[model samples]
Target chain A: MTGSASGLESPAEDLLKVQDLLVHFPVKVPLIQRLISREKVVVHAVDGVSFSLKRGEILGLVGESGCGKTTVGRTIVRLLEPTSGRIIFEGRDISHLSQSKLRPLRRRMQIIFQDPHASLNPAMTIGRAIGHPLQIHGIVRDAEEVRQSVLDIMREVGLTPEDQLFDKYPGDLSGGQKQRAVIARAMILEPRLLVVDEGVAMLDMSVRAKVLELILNLKRRHGLTYLFITHDLATAKFLCDRIAIMYLGRVVELGPAASIYAEPKHPYTQALLQVIPTPDPDKRRKKILPRGEVPDAIHPPAGCRFHPRCQSVLPTCGWEGRDFIDLLDEHLSTSPKGVEDDELLGSIGEWWAEGFEAGRKTDAKDPKKLVERVKEILAKAPPAMAQAVQSVEAKGEFVIVQFRTPDKLVHTAVADRTVECLLYQ
Target chain B: MKAKHSDPKRASSLPEIPLPFLGRLIHPLIRERRSLAGALSWMGLGILFFFIFIAVFAPLLVPFSQTQPFASPVLQAPSLQHLMGTDNVGRDVLSRVIWGARTSLEIMAIGVLIALAVGFPVGLLSGYVGGKIDRLLVLIMDSIYAFPGLLLAALIAAVIGRGVFNIGIAITVIYIPLYFRVTRSQTLSVREEPYVEAARALGAKSHTVMFSYIAHSAIIAIPVIFSLSSADAILTAAGLSYLGLGLEVDTPGDWGRDLSDAQSFIGVGIWWMSVFPGLMIVILTVGLSFLGEGLNDIINPILRKERS
Candidate 1:
């Protein structure tokens, strides 16, 4: 443990440690599903991932979407219970502590999430959400003092006129504002180390930069250490002091962030860098779409997980027959940014929003007639909007309204942030 | 090993700007889903509520305030005086129908509350703490579920001596397993959600973890289970009354007794006596199912629809 309270020379060595962590999920078949159940298997989401950070040092953990980066972040904060691991914070292992024992220590370790919306409780106002950690840690008992503390944390996250944002629900806040609320909640603890798991990925590109700047500024001001888990090598480079690239369930490379990006050693690390969308159009030609789809976690390949699809394949690379088709499929899927989803979701949200707004403004003369008219308006909307609106209308009608679609596979990495594939080999 | 200076001034733990939602004493329930314009999804729910309105606020709706008809002949057929006709006791079937709403509905609702009130905390503690506690709770619930619910309800009814409250208590005991299973499964899933972890990271106690993060997630399961158990509750209560072991035989406003009493008169072909009470039960069950399902879907879409 490098980051203890007694006194170290720099913020970079205050201490963050994870010892031999493991998390395995059980997948079982119902009696009817037995024939196809094949065999009971465990999806080892995280296997023996261990690393540490100093008081203010940023330890960048980079990997593809399912490479367990987020799981590792959650586990360190004990958000996801480790099958067997030790999380040492400020030189004390909190692993396996009873909930009672963990309570006081909780204020010392906090986390920021990828989806600001999902991470926040929608029913709570942003200020309450931020002040929650303060209350839980018993930082302020007096009502007046809690309010002042919340406003100050809000300012640190860059929300203006702190009073204005104090009353907004997570639903009302914009992407950046929601992210700031999450940060405010985590920071209220004045935690020594913050686990930020792709915290800015959900924001718009323009807003993302501002949020990232706010984060870096907070780090400087508080001397807060960070365990920044991301798939984006570029963000990792910008935010981390040191970087560790995970593949399958293990770190394949570890070094200073600049060196790992500038001079990657592992084949997975090299491939990830080569795929970065280079600004110099000439340099763009070198983009290497990763060769294989991320294996279904429940049934991963044997021996060196990336070997099956590696162009740098060798007898030692763990190449297998299924790897070829998987590689071809990957090449096909990455030809161009697949159809942009922003436009579709935006159009649908807009249509539903308009319909609901109109529904509210409709004269009270007859709700039935208003509903019928709303239905007609929805039928005439654009295709995506029409579907979204229809669903919204049926909402509270046939069933409670829900618009959950399949969680699409996203290229979560921004620039040279990932360390999967084999181009850097 | 190394350490860093603890700088109190730089804690900069203060907000950079304002936070809007702070200082609220309570969390507001998100009024996210509006119901079918409250039009009443099923014909049964409408009819059930109509009858209830007549029973509770009878003077307002019905032209005649008398719930107890003064002069109706035994086994009488349908007429203006006795819309559903008279039972063997010579009481108005329609009055009984209106009054029966209070009895059956109270049983269903109270039984469910019992299941939730008694079973929820047990299920939560079992799943979250796990180990010996989980096994002990599981053993008790598994034994309860092992009994055929109706027979189990009958046994409890028999033991408690066939009264209205006895029948409901019996039903509540019989159905505790369903609530236990539903709640335990939900807690198992919710305890793993990220926010629960986030809450724990903030030093939230187990009680807070149980009620705060997991409860809402667990609550979505409530409507679905309520819908499910309401169906069970209605059927079991009706079954017991029909069997002569539920709701004391001489009790007024008994739908089960109405049905059972309707049995011997069948030869005379006065079917509306049995048909109306049976229909009332169907409506209440179906209405509850639809409303509960509708609520669940709005609150937690993923549960309503699972994808590959």
Candidate 2:
């Protein structure tokens, strides 16, 4: 762990370390539901995610929605309790600390939420909202000192006319002003680690850059360590010193921002980079687009979770009967000239990976010709899919396609990075 | 996160620009939900103050002792000597009615204060630290709430024995469930709000989060509930007294007991006995209801904003 922390001769030292954090939320069911369903269902929101933050470093956790990037940020600040993990902050394990025990440590770590509108109490005035931490933590004993400090911090956050805005409620402020107030409140305690969960995603385009700049300025001023969670790659590139690209509740790639942008290692990271629409239309950048939607976290792909959608997928990248069906469907959707009315096509939706036997009631005059046409179509498929197909035969008017059992791709070290693909493994 | 249609320049100026304290208090009354709040404030304040004044200065107005009877005619009608006439025992009916204000106020004050004291903290705990404790509290409160309030008060009063303190205790029992339910429900929602999470993130302990973040927001409904519950308490106390579960029969100036005594005199055309006590109960309850509704309009910003 110490060797990993000192990987590079960086000036700053490690401030926070998180190891193999898993947060699963049990789906609440009534007693009758529990009795009827023998198995307990849990949403694996964050599964085995781990990363560390260096002092004065901005580590962006970037992923698509439901990738559990936000959960990683929240769990670090102890906002959301991890099911099991080692969250060593300043060399102390505070992962499973009680609420009372966590209270004092809360002053050292803070979290700013995405929606400024929903982040401040509507009932409390701006002054009280910002000063509440000071009062609660006994940081400032005098009310006058708290007010003066609140006004000073308010000005620092660019909320001018602090005296006038002091008594105003959250509903009274605009989006940008509300965010500034929120930032002021979060920073007044001078927290060392800040978990910003999509903090600027709710602000308008005009104010986004200014807010981002303000964040950078604050980081420089206070030497703050940030776990910045966001889905926008562009913003993450601008603000994050280092970026961790997450996929299906795991960090697939973690490196410096410059290196990642220059040459992204993971397939998922490469696909995410391609998503940013280039302004220069003349330069047609070759995009490596993932094939389908993200797999469900509850039942993630057996090998690399990104394997189902990965364009750089190998034969051993968890390819199963469903993968074969997807390829068949894709081939048919594009050409479907011969098997346009196949009944089995619609029935593929109900089939799971565990071996299934279904017969198509076809009135085709030449079953041999149909099988030849399907074979011809299969020959044109991608090499990975083409190789996976073991058998394609016409058995009594039914065209059967059997795929080889896919070997699970295990994670292996490629250079300094961890890559979960057979090509690298 | 869509920018509202309102200009940014103006929206920034909307909340923080301070108005004078007096103006801030009066502004909502003038503009937001004007007609209803204004009418209620005037009527309710008028009646409420009238009762409060009577409660404070009952002795100054009453010519004779409230509990003891006078040497005047047993069933005297309205006259210059005995204003509003006299009861069947020759006691000045007006004196007892005036003094009834003090007794009614005592019940309202004791019942609400005790109910709030017991209900508020319990509700706050049940909501803020929800789990087995919350389930247990909800079960207990619901069980208590399931019984008809008046009947429960009567049952409690029967066990506690007939006295002013017993009456207040019985009324408190009925009102506690009301406060607990309201506070718990309000706390449940407030606890989930991001602001509460923000407070927790700011190093606030459990008690601080409960009282400062959750309770502070949840307490807005309290003034409304307090006024409304006072009205409820008045009726429940009167009902208990009328059912012989409240103050002793010999205790004079109790509106419920007075009403019970007035039943025999109604046949003899002694309308003053029933009319004054009944009107006092009606006026006080109406006053409290109006005050409660008026405070709600002022306190609930959503309702105030809708009207504006």
Candidate 3:
């Protein structure tokens, strides 16, 4: 099923809607250190993401590891509490609901994890593990009825000879069998929405195809909707109706799967698509993989999170003090140390940046020479970075560098999708 | 299409023994026979069972009452009439030694059971509901763990006074930290496992997740700690009695009290008074130690696999 019929569906048909959802995890600090600093630091795992899914939709959440696609999926199912935002499922706000209130709603939403071996309790038999949810929710009280329901779900998921496998432990089953059992456990509750977080990533290639097919089959039989989270684009293309491309905890582009694959709008999405391997030997497609490791989430880039690694970066695309410090650090480490250069700019350690302004103490050294050295460094830097700098001035014993305020970024609607980029705007 | 039933890795390693229960019990011992720990564990099990047999049949096996005096000369040597000969009180030494097994076993069982009863739930709550409760429990347990086992037992024994149950309670105080530390650490690790999270995601309450998922997996190391601590408790119990803080004089036979009484006679060359009882304590403690070590060797690999 694809998004051919999506345009015709009314807003009333929306099954789930997320508005600016944010999940920030506070970094643990020692008590003495915390008291002295009085500064609270948090990892902006899922900064501000908004998306919606229609009924009977299979929306794929595609991103690199640590980009927070899994976090979004978890937050939707209320497995993780959102720091701020609204999660409207079936027309009710579930974002701030208490756990007890969410318990009844749990029957309508479920999550299947990546590693099946770890997701099933080693001590519990497959039958008991699968039927436990029914008992917990008090849906099926009779022992025989629970067993019958468990056996039926097992048979549906293609775990044949269900009677024999029912009494077996997780260690007794193979990887594929364990995954199928995990899926069976989730499906036995007859949930309306399933968030499959890399559900088949750990399985063999042969088993992966079978599990994907089973997922599609289950959706068809139950008319279930899915928020599929995975790093594998090919698998997403094969299964998803819509695709949302995430980079550094934000969705850069979101649209129909076929159109996004055929013509990616965002630079990050284009870079991701080029890295996917093709079978043909004669076609040597140029790979444009992004450079540098992901920046720490504690202090993400000021403007667009992906601007640091974006190949098509613009002057207005959110570059700040941290980026300048990083560039200076790179320059200092590689170039041979000059006595004059060392005298003018004491060390990289003395330099500090916040927002668009970066300052370094002169310490009685000539401020004019420091300003000149900074300008000289900027001359050789990337054109976009150099153009973004507004001025460099010397005042008292400190040299200050100021960058221009970037153009306000927003999710602009392009041809058939929404892209958060200056190029689209 | 029917999926092929691959044999479970654990079941295949076990030999095809007739009795399922006995085979399961002996499987780890047989598998680990090549290791020194395994060999020692087997010897320990044998010694432990021998002592257990004596403790169970103390009434039938003893030749005289544990405390009664007879019309025989004191400090008599080994003979057919007195068997291992009479003590300084004109009582049979063999009967007292045989009866001491029952006392030691009683102290061990009660002491360890009490420690487990108090320590397990406290640890489970501390580890599972971690934060302030965890920090508080860890502080308390660490303070208890800092004290020497005998010294702590002695202090408690002195305050609680002497008797079988009181001595057991005294010994229990020394080991509370051991069980607490083991269970708490195990719970802390198991709480992070994916299965525990999965159970929580399935609408299971906090208590349900703690007991069913976390507790089930965390309990693997408890048995290993149990046997080893039982061995340690035997020593502490005897030490308490030796210091004259344990059972009353002329009560059912106790090794520590007997050892204490024999100390004054040892210089006069009455070797029988101390040798038999001392030998019994050493054998039982060593047996328990071997059992504990062997269990560690067998169970540790399984725990490691579970973690991975």
Candidate 4:
């Protein structure tokens, strides 16, 4: 991949590379429950996310709140351990390193949190909190030296009158000043890369612009690489050299910010870009929001994670038994003759779905009528859902509805970007 | 350019005032919460310090010996010679009351400090590095907390035998669970704060994050707990001494011991004997309770704001 910005030579050497990173958090279950169903449930927070950061490059991780962008940012910095995958920093795999072993490496990378108000120790003075890292890493032993360094960073971040503000507590600072102090704290370590996890998301609009300006300025001045995690595509367009649009826990589209904005390849990216509110009052546009809430991460949809909500969904996008069940439920709820359909279909509780196959008990009902009813429901469903059905037949005492196995989805190169969509594949 | 808005004069005009150790400790609390509750807390603090000062300067404050018995003047009422009157044994009632503050202060200091020292770390560890260890600690602390405070202290005092230190231990046992529960709960919440995560991302050691970030935030509740438990400790110490599980009689002046001694004299209407000591106990306990209540009012809002 080539760098997006003009007038800057793109470096071949990667400062940070994350390969197939996966972070799954185990959900706590009662002992008896765990033992009874020996299924180890986990939240697939960041699954198989891969990216690389070039020196001085600003890579934006953009997605909705639960899209695992924050988890990916945190996992890259080793704040959250990756359940699998390699995180190579400067040609060394540092993902699995113990915290003690990661200490020295931490000085080369840092994280700026989302909330300025909550990201500072209230009891600690601004100066002490900012300088604490130097003490922790034993980078500056002398208090005076640490103070000078902290004050320098404090000034750079525009928390001015640094000497006086040094003794003031975080409680004394406004939200903007607090965010600046937090930035100064991270900048004091002189890290090569920064994972800014929605760093300016909590700031006011005017202050957000200033902070974004400061971020860009810092990048230029310090030659720093940034893994900028934000949900605002407009902010990403403003600051990012490249943007990776994540959906659920996977990167759906990743390419130059300008190109992606000009021509979004993935349907998810297109939908995301289409929703950015225009500043002009006269230019009213239709918002193409993805249907339904983000699916639960515990059991992410198979084939394509976004297919369930994709507006331009293809037949092979990924249709499974759950989708069929969802279609049946929707048809029953909205059908004009719902009472007749309910009697024909029986209670949905007796239906069972696993993988691509759904079956209903036909012992009480006529098996031929059950198959006919299932076919009628499919005929009224979304074309993609109906087109994916392989067969509907009465086998033994059950009417089994089987769906075709979708082709394996893979990230494919489209114009100026790589998108994980069947449309591109 | 943005820095120009801030007045350099105003910034420099406020001189840094180097406070004395105790003033420094209390400066933030008083500064943050300046209300009627704050004034009441100050009054409570004053009462506590008044007792402490009397305890520290007991020898100079009262002239008559606390234990020495005179032949004539037994059961004398308040007069110029011996204010607060003389006890049944003719020992100065005023002197015994003044000296009793020392014993109570000692128990308060030992009980609170030991409880804080032990409970703070245990609770911090249990909450910060949670899992089986947390469950285990919560179980243990809850078990200890389930027993009635005075009953547990009395039982411990009964088993350990009697002395100032033994009574202090009894008070400590009663309060450790209190501190543990408060610190543990606070730590549990503070552990989830974004600041702690920021500190960890900065590569702070587990101990540093625990003590510096988690402990510092968790410690706000401790003072409230400290004041309340100290009031409880004073009562526990007195209860132990009254039940014959504290210092031996006449070795040092003790309110509980003196009150016990004056119990029989009440039938003769020599009220001076029990009244003064009982009054001291009541006054100190009320002061601490007010201090604790006022502090809770002042700090709870701050804690809630921090959480949000």
- How would you encode candidate 4's per-residue C-alpha lDDT over A40-100 as one tens digit per residue? 9999999899989999999999999999999998888898889999998877788989989
Worst 10 residues of 3 chain A by lDDT: A1-10
- Candidates in order have lDDT scores of 0.68, 0.80, 0.88, 0.87
On residues A1-425, what C-alpha lDDT tens digit does candidate 2 reach at each position? 47734542354556889898999988888999999989878878888877788889999999999999888887888888999978988777889998788888888899999988778877678998898889998989899999999999999998879997898877778999999999999999999889999999988888989899999999999888898999999999999998888998888888888788888888889989999878899876888688879878776665667877878877666556566666666765666453563443434453334332222334566666656655676688777766766776667756666666667555566665565557666
How high is the lDDT of residue A309 in model 4? 94
* Candidate 2 residue B69 C-alpha distance from true site, Å: 1.6
Listed in order, the DockQ scores are: 0.23, 0.49, 0.43, 0.54
Off by over 4 Å in 4: A1-11, A280-287, B1-36, B151-162
DockQ of candidate model 1: 0.23
At residue B301, what lDDT does model 4 achieve? Answer: 84
Residue-by-residue lDDT tens digits, candidate 3, A1-425 = 13523543454567789999999999999999998997798999998999999888999999999999999998999989999999988777899999998898888889999999999998788999999999999999999999999999999999878998888778879999999999999999998889999999999999999999999999999988999999999999999999999987899999999999999999999999987888896896878888798888898898888888888899899878877888888878776866666777768999999899898877755577778889998888888988898888987777888888888889999988999999888
Candidate 3 error regions (>4 Å): A1-12, A333-347, A363-370, B1-26, B65-67
For model 2, the superposed segments whose C-alpha errors exceed 4 Å read: A1-12, A280-292, A321-350, A355-383, A389-423, B1-30, B63-66, B249-252, B293-308
Tell me what TM-score chain A of model 3 achieves. 0.95
Residues forming the 10-long window of minimal summed lDDT in candidate 2 chain A: A350-359
Residue-level lDDT of model 4, residues B127-189, one tens digit each, is: 888999999998998898899988998898889887778788888987888888898999988
Deviating ranges (above 4 Å) for candidate 1: A1-13, A17-52, A64-68, A79-87, A94-99, A122-125, A141-148, A159-173, A245-272, A282-425, B1-45, B58-98, B125-143, B224-228, B266-308
Model 4 quality (TM-score): 0.92
Q: What is the C-alpha RMSD of each candidate to the true structure, in Å?
A: 20.3, 5.9, 4.5, 4.5
